[model samples]
Target chain A: MGLKEFCFKKSLWVFHLSAGSCNNCDIEILDLLTPRYDIERFGMKLVGSIRHADVLLVTGIVTNKTKSRVLEIYSQASKPVLVIAIGACPCTGGIFTSSYNFAGPLDKVIPVDAYIPGCPPKPEAMLAGVVKLLKSKNRE
Target chain B: MGKKTIVPIGPYHPLLEEPEFFKLYCDGEKVVDMEWETGYNHRGIEKICESKTFEQVFYVVERICGICSTSHPFAYANAVESIPGVEIPVRAKLIRSIVGELERVHSHLLWVGLAGHFLGYNTVFMWAWKYREPILDMFEIITGNRNSYAMFTIGGVRRDISEENADKLLKVLMDAKKKISLLTGAVMDDPVIHARLKGVAVLTAKDIHDFGAIGPTARASGVDIDIRRDDPYAAYEMVDWKVITAKEGDIFAKAEVRLMEMFESISIIKQCLELLKKENKGDIKVKVKEIPPGIGIGRAEAPRGEVFHFVKSDGSNSPVRHKIRAPSYNCITTFRRSCIGGTISDAAIATAAVDPCYCCTERMTQVYDIKTGKKMMNAAELIKLSQKKTEEIRAKGDKND
Candidate 1:
C-alpha cells in the first residue's frame, strides 16, 4: 500500500454533518463513540472541523435549508474524503420524502462511498459499514 | 461599554448535535444579547404527518426527538384516542408509562453525559454513558430498538412486554438504581462541580412562568407543573411517585432535578410493572373502527419537558391538520432571560441546561443580516472557554486543600 493510503487507513478523522435529520441517526452515530462501541480503538475519531476530516459522515434527509451548507462543507474538506450516508433518510429519503423541505437521497447531492440504511442504523451496523468502506478503498 | 463582538455558533457546529444558529453578542467576556435562528433541521414533520394514516403517524412522530422518542408517540396516541374517546386497556396504559419512564432515564443520562463533555470533564461523560448502556439493552429486549422504540400506537402499544421481559427489566432497573445513586453522590459532593454549576445561570420562578417553561426547567424553579401529574395521562396517575423540584433554578438545580427524576422514573416503572402483572398479556390495544370529525389535544411529559400534540380529524383516514408543540419551544426562548448578563462561559451550559433538542425545536428558518459581519469565535472555542473556567475552578479547589 502507498504511504498516503496507509496513513488514511490507519487513522480516519470523521466529520459528522446533520442535513435535516430527526436526530435518531445522529444519536446512533454518537453512540459509536461511547465506551461500548468506542470507535477510537480503530483510530477513528470525530473531528470538529471539516478541513481535517477523511470521512464525511452525513446523517438526515438533506433538507433545502441545509443543502447548501452540506455542499459547502463537502467542498471544504481536503480531497479523497469518503462521504458516508448513515440512515434510511439520507439513503432513500425515508418517510419525510414527500415533505416540502426534502432535498435529498444524498447520493444525488454528493457522491456517497457507503450507505448504512436503518431508520436509525445500530452502532454495530455503523462500525461494520465504516470498516467495509475502508477495505474497499484499500483494494482500489 | 466594551466593544461588541458577534460569536456565531452554528447552522453546523460541533457543540450542537443538530443544526441551529445562535448569535451571541458579547461585550468583552459577558454576553449582552443573544439571537437564535432554527429551521436547519426542519423536515416539516407536521406536514408529513398529515399525509399518513392515523396508524402510520405514530412512527413519524416518534422520530421528532430521538432522545425523547416515546414522548411524541405517547402524546400523538393520546390525541388520536381522545378523538373517539377510546380508552386503552390497563395493560397498554402500564406499558406506555413504562416506555415513557424508560425514555426519561436514558434521555437524562444522555444530557448528563453531554453536560459533562461540554464542561471538559470527559470522565463524567464516559461514566454516565457507560451506565446508560444497560438501560438501552433493556429497551432493546422489550421494544426491539435502542433509540426509537416505536412502542406506542393509537389506542395502545404495538407490542406487549411479556412476563419474562418484565422480570429482566426489573433486574436491570434494580442494578441501575444503585449505579445512578453512586453517580448522583459523586456529582453532588464534587467541589469543582459545585463551583462550576451552582448559581451559574439562575432563573427565577417568575421567569419560568413568564416563559411558560415546563418539565424540569419549570420544576427546577419550583413552578410545580408536570403534564403527567397535572393532566395525569396513561398510568402516571395510577403509579406512586413524586415530582422532583428544586428552588435554585440554576444549572445545578436543573442537573439535580434531572438526576433525581431518573429515580422517580425507576419507581414509576416498577409500579407499572407490578400493575401489568394483573392484566392479561394479549390485552394490549383497543381496536377503533373509525374516527368521527373532531379535534383532540394530547400532552405528555417528556424528559426535557411537556410535549403537546393537537390532532384535527375530518372523519378521514389521515388527520386534516397535526400541530406539534415540543417543550423546547418554550424552554429555548428562556435563554434570553438566563443567558443575558452571564459570562460567555456560563452561557454554554445555560443554553444546554434546558437539554435543547433542535429537531424538536425547528419549525421555521429566517434569513437575518449580521451587522458586525465578523466571526470572532465558533462553538468549539466557546466550549473551550467553559472548560477553561472549570479547570480554573478545579485548580483553585486543589490549592485550597
Candidate 2:
C-alpha cells in the first residue's frame, strides 16, 4: 500500500496518558468517543495499548513518579507518532504546578505536537485538536 | 494444563491510570486470581493541613480533587462550625443544601459519562455529557468558577444565589430533568450496556460495610447510609428527598442508582430555589472569629460517595494536616478480589465503574529493563528520533533568526 493511503486509512489510534491529571481531562477524553462527538466515526478510536496507538494524548502535569511511565508510553508507540498534550495541567502545570511534587509540563519528557488548554479542556476542543493534528501530518 | 500467565495491569496503564497495580493471574480468557496495590497519589494533603488556620485550611482542603472540591470544604467547614456550636443562618443552611445537591447533579452526570465510556457505550457517554454542560453553566452562574467553586466558607457560604440566578436555575433544572429522564431510560434499557455491565464486579453489602465503602458503592450494595440524611447538614434537614439505593452491588446497579439520584437532586434544587424566592433576602454567610485550636472531622456525601476531610489546626496560617479520603479510596480496596475471573477487556469496565480518579490517586515507581521489556524498538532508536526532532527545531529557530 502507498504510505499516504496506509497512514490515512489506519487513522490515528489514541492512547490517553494520565501524567498525574485530575481525572477531569481523562473523563473528557472518554467523553469524545461517546455518541455526541462519536470520535470513532471520524476513524479515531481510543486504544488501550500504546503499542497499537498512532497518537498519545497526555493530560496533567508530569510528576516525578509518573515521568518514567510517560516516557515509557511514548517509547512504546511506533515511530511517526504524534503526542497531543491535552488540558491546561499538562500544557502549563495548571493549579498543581506550585506543588513540590510536580516535575514540570509534559513537554519536559517528550515532544508535544499540540496543546489543548483548559483545566480540563472541553470534549469538543479535544476532538478539534486531534483533527488538526491528523490533517497536518506533522507527527511523521 | 497450560501455565497461568501473570499480567500486570498498571501503576501506569492506559485503560486504568490511577497509579494502581493490578496483577492478574490469567489462563487465556479467564482470570484466576488478582492483587491490587494503591497509595500512588498520596500527597500528604492531611499533613499539609497541620499548620494552616481553620479559615485558610478550608480553601487548601478543597484542592484535594476538583470533582469533589465543594464537598470537602463544606464538610470541613461544617465540622469546624459544629465545634463552635454556631447556628448557621437559615438561608445559609438552605443554600448549602442547594449548592451541595447542585454539585451532585454535575458530578453524577460526569460519572454517567465515564460509566458509559468504560462499557464502550460512546453514544450514552456523549448524550450524558451534552446534558451535563447546561448544569455546569448553572454552576458557573451561581459560583463564578464551574469546577472549583469556592462557594463554601466556614460557618456559611461565601455568596448567595440571587433571585435572578434562582429563576435561571429553575429553568435549567427543568431542562436537566427532561434530559435525565431520557438518559435514565436509555441507559437502563440499552442491550449492549446491560450485557457488559450487569452482574459484573459484584460487591456484596456485607463486603461493602466491612471494607468501609461509602457513597454510591455502599448504596449500590444496599447499605442505607447517606450522610445527607443520617447526619443532616445545611438545608438537607429542611428539604424532602429520598436516599436512592440498590441491592445489586455491581456496575449496572451503581449507574441506575446515580441516574435515579439525579431526580432527587432536581427535587432538592426545586425546593431550595423555591425557598430562595420566598425568603427573598437574608445573610448569606455569617461573620465568624478564629476557630479554636483542635482537630476536626468533616463528612459529606460527594457525588461519587462519602468524602471525609480531617483537618488539624495549630492556630496558624494554613492547616497542619488535611487528610482527604475520596470515595474511590474505599472502592479500590475491593479491586483485587473482584477482578478475579474477569478478562483483560473487562478490567477497564471493572476499574472505571468505581470512578477511580488517577489524578488524585498517587503513583509508585515502575522500573523495567529497556532491552528486555516489551518494546516495538530499542531506547537508542527512540532517543535518536528525539535528537533528530530537536535538531530540526533548532534549524527552524536559526532560520527564523
Candidate 3:
C-alpha cells in the first residue's frame, strides 16, 4: 500500500454529519467513543471538523433543509474522503421516505462508500462495516 | 456597551449531535440574547403517521427520539387506545412501565455523560456511559432493540418480559444502581465539578412555569409537574416512587436531578419487575376491532420530560390526524430565559441542560442576514470558551486551597 493509503488505514478520522436523524444513529456513533465499543482502539476517532475528516460518516435521512448543508460539507472535505451512510434512513430513506421534507436516499445526493443498515445499526455492526470498508479500500 | 457579535452553532456543529441551529447574540463575552432555528431534522412524522395504519404508527413514533424511543410509542398507544376506550391488561402495563423506566435510566445517564463532556470532563462522560450499558442490555433483553425498543402497541405491548429476562434485568439493575451510586457520590463530592457547575445558568420556577417546561427541567426549579404523576399513565401510578426535585434551578441542580432520577428509575424498574412476577404472562396485547370516530390525547413522562400525543380517528385503521408535542418543544424554549445574561461559556451547558432532542422538536430554520452571516462564530469556538472558563474556575479553586 502507498504511504498515504497505509496512514489512512491506520487512523481514520471520521466526521459525523447528522443529516436529519432521530438521534438514534448519532447516539450509536457516540457509543463508539464510549468504553464498551471504543472505536479509538482501532485508531478511529470522531473529529469535529469536516475538513480534517478522512471519512464523512453521514447519519439520518437527508431532509430538504440539510441537503445543501450536506452537499456543502461533502465538498468542503479534502479529497479521498470515504462517505459512509449509517442507519436505514440514509441508505434507503427508511420509514420517512414518504415525508414531505424527505430529500434523500443519500447515495443520490452524494457518493457513499459503505452503507450500515439498521433502524439504528448496532455499534458492533457499525464497527464491522467500517473494518470491511477499510479492507476493501486497501484492495484498491 | 460591548460590540454585539453573532455566534452560530449547528446545522452541523460538534457540540450538537442533531441538526439544529442556534444564534447566540453576544455583547462581548456575555450572551445578551439567543435565537434557535430547527426544521433540519423534521421528517414530517405527524403527517406520516396519518398515512400509516395505527399498528405501523408505533414504529414511526419510536424513531421520533431514539433516546426516549419508547416514550413516544407509550404516549401514542395511550392516545390510540383511549380513542377505542380500550384498557390494556395489567401485565402489559407493568411491562410498559419497565420499558419506560429503563429508558429513563439510560436517557438520564446519556444526558449526564453529555453534560460532563460539555464541561470538558471526559472522565464523568466515560463513567456515566459505561454504567449506562447495563440498562441498554436490559432493554435488548426485554424489547429486542437497544435504542428503539418498539415495545408499545395500541392496546398493549408487542413483547412479553419473561421470568428469566426479568430476573436477569433485575440483577443488572442492582449492579447498575451500585455503580451509579458510586459515580453520583464522586460527582456530588467533587470540588471542581461544584465550582464549574454550581450557580451556573440559574432558572427560576417562574421561568419554568412561563415556558411550560416539564420533567426534570421544571422539577429542578421546584415546579412540581410530572405527567407520569399528574396524569398517571401506564404503570407509573401502579408503582411507588416519588418525583425528584431540587429548589435551585441551575446547571448543577439539573445534573443532580437527572442523576437522582436514575435511582428513582431503578427503583421503579425493580418494583415493576416484582409486580411482573405476580402477573400472568402472555396476556400482553388485546385485539381491537375498530376505533369509533373521536379525538384522544395521551401523555407520558419521557426521560427529558412530558411527551404528548393527540390522535384523531374516524372509525378506520389509520388516524386522520396525529399531533405530537415532545418535552423538548417547551424545555428547549426556556433557553431564552436561562441563557441570557450568562457568559458565552455557560450558554452551551445551559442550552444542553434541557436535554433538547432536535428530532422531536425541529420545525423551522433560522433566517440569516447576508451582511452579518460571514462573521459568525462556530461551535468549536463556543466550546473553547466553555472549556477556558472551566480552566479558569479550576485555577481559582487551586489558588483558594
Candidate 4:
C-alpha cells in the first residue's frame, strides 16, 4: 500500500458537508466522537477545513443553493481522498429526496466510496460503515 | 485598533453544521455589527408537508430536526387530533409526555456537552455525552429508534409504553439523573467556567421581548412564557412543575437554565411513569372516522422552545397548507440582540446561546482581523482559547494543592 493510502485509512480526517439535510446525520457524525461510540480510537477526526481532510463525510441531500459550494469544497480537499456519504439523506435523499429544492443524491455530483443507509443511522452502524469503506479500499 | 472588519461565517463553513451566513463587523477585539444570511438550510418542508397524507406528514415534520424530532410530531398530532374532534386516551397522553420529556433531557444534555466543548471543557463534553447515551437508549427502548422517532401519529402515538418496560425506563431515568447532577455540579462549581461564561454576551429582558425569543433563550432573560403552561398540551398541564428561568440573560444563564431543566425533565418523566401506572391507562390510540374542513393550530414546548404547527385542511386527506415553526425560528433571531458589542471570542458562544438547530450550531465561525486583513479566529480557535483559560486555571489549582 502507498504512504498516502495507509495514512488515509489509519487516521481519516473527515470534513463533513450537509447539502440540505435535517441535521440528524450531522449529529450522528458528531456522536461518533463521544465516549459512547468512540470513533477517535480509529483515528477519525472532524477537521475545520476541507484542506486538512483525508475523507469527506457528506450528509444531507444536495440542494440547489449548496450544489456548487459542495463541489468547490470537494475540490479543496487534497488527493487520495475518500468520500463516504453518511445517512439516507445524502445516499438516497431519504424522505426529502423528492422535494423540489433537492439536486439529487451526492453520488451524482461527487464520487462516493460508500453509502450508510438509515433515517439517521445508529452510531454503531455509522462506525461500521466507515470501517467497511476503509476495508474495501485496502486493495486500492 | 480602529479599522472595522467583517468576520463572514458561512453559507457553508466548518464552525456550523447548517448553511446560514453571518457578517460580523468588528473593531479589533470586539464585535460592533453583524448581519445574517439564511435560506441555506431551508428545504421547503412546509411545502412538502402539504402534499403528503395527514398520516405521512407526522413522519415529514419529525425529520424537520433530528435533535427536536418529537416536538414537531407532538404539535402536529395535537393539531390533527383537534381537527377530527377526537380525544386521545389518557395512557397516550402520559406516554407522549414521557417521550417528549425524554427528548428534552437528551437534547439539553447534548447542548451542555456542546457548550462545554465550545468553552474548552472536553472533560465536561465527554462526561455529559456519556450520560446522554442512556437517554438515547431509553428512546430506543420506547420509540424503537433514536433521532427521528416515528412514534406519533394523527389521533395519538403509534407505540405504547407497556407495563414491562416501565421499570426499565424508571431505572434509566434514575441513572441519568445521577449522572446529570455530577455533570451540572462540575460545570457550576468550576471557577474557570464562571470566568469564561459569566456576564458574557448578556441579552437583557428587553432584548428578549423585542426579538420575540422563546424557550431557554427567552427564559434566560426572565421572560416567563412557557407554552406548556400557557397553552398546555399533552400531559404538561397535569404534571406539577415550574418553568426554569434565569434573570442574568448571559451565556451562563442559558447553560444554567438548561442544566436545571435536565433534572426537571427527569422528575417530570418519573411523575409520568407513576401516573401511567396509577391513573392514565388503557388504549393508546383512537381511530378517527372522518376529517372536517377547518384550520387547527397546535403548539408544544420543544426542548428549544414552542413548536407551533398550523394545519389548514379543506376536507382532504392531505392538508392545503401545513405550516410548522421550529423554536429556532424565533430563537436564532436573538443573535442580533446578543452578539453585538461582545469580544470575537464570545461571538461563537453568544450566537450558539440559543442552541440553534442548524443541528451542529458551533461548528463554523470566522473572524477577520481588519488591520492584518487575515482571518483572526474560526470557531475551533475560539474553543482553544476557552480551553486554554481552563487549563491555566487547573494548573493554578494543582499548584495550590
- Which lDDT tens digits does candidate 3 get at residues B101-134? 8888899899989998998999989999999988
Angstrom error of the Cα, residue B55, model 1: value is: 0.6
Q: In what order do the candidates fall by TM-score, top score first?
A: 1, 3, 4, 2
lDDT by residue (A7-124, candidate 3, tens digit) is 5667889999999899999999999899999989878898889998899999999988789999999999998899999999999999999998899699999999999999889999
In terms of DockQ, the best-performing candidate is 3
lDDT of 3 at B120: 93
Ranking by DockQ: 3, 1, 4, 2
Better of 1 and 4 by lDDT: 1
Clashing pairs in 4: B14-B363, B14-B364, B15-B363, B15-B364, B16-B363, B16-B364
C-alpha positional error of residue B399 in candidate 4 after TM-score superposition, expressed in Å: 86
Report lDDT per candidate: 0.90, 0.75, 0.88, 0.84
lDDT of 1 by residue, A64-91 (tens): 8788899999999998788999989899
Which docking class does model 2 fall in? Answer: acceptable
C-alpha DockQ of every model: 0.66, 0.26, 0.74, 0.42
What docking tier does model 3 reach? medium
Which wins on DockQ, candidate 3 or candidate 4? 3
lDDT of 2 by residue, B1-401 (tens): 68989888787665564556778888897888787665445443455455446676665566567676778788887777765567888888888888888888888888887677667776776788889878777877998865677787777788888888889999999988998999998988988888988988898988887778778878988999898899887888787889999999988998888889999999998998888777777787777776656777778888877777676666554556666667777777777656776877787788777776644444223334468854444567768988999999999999999
Off by over 4 Å in 1: B365-401
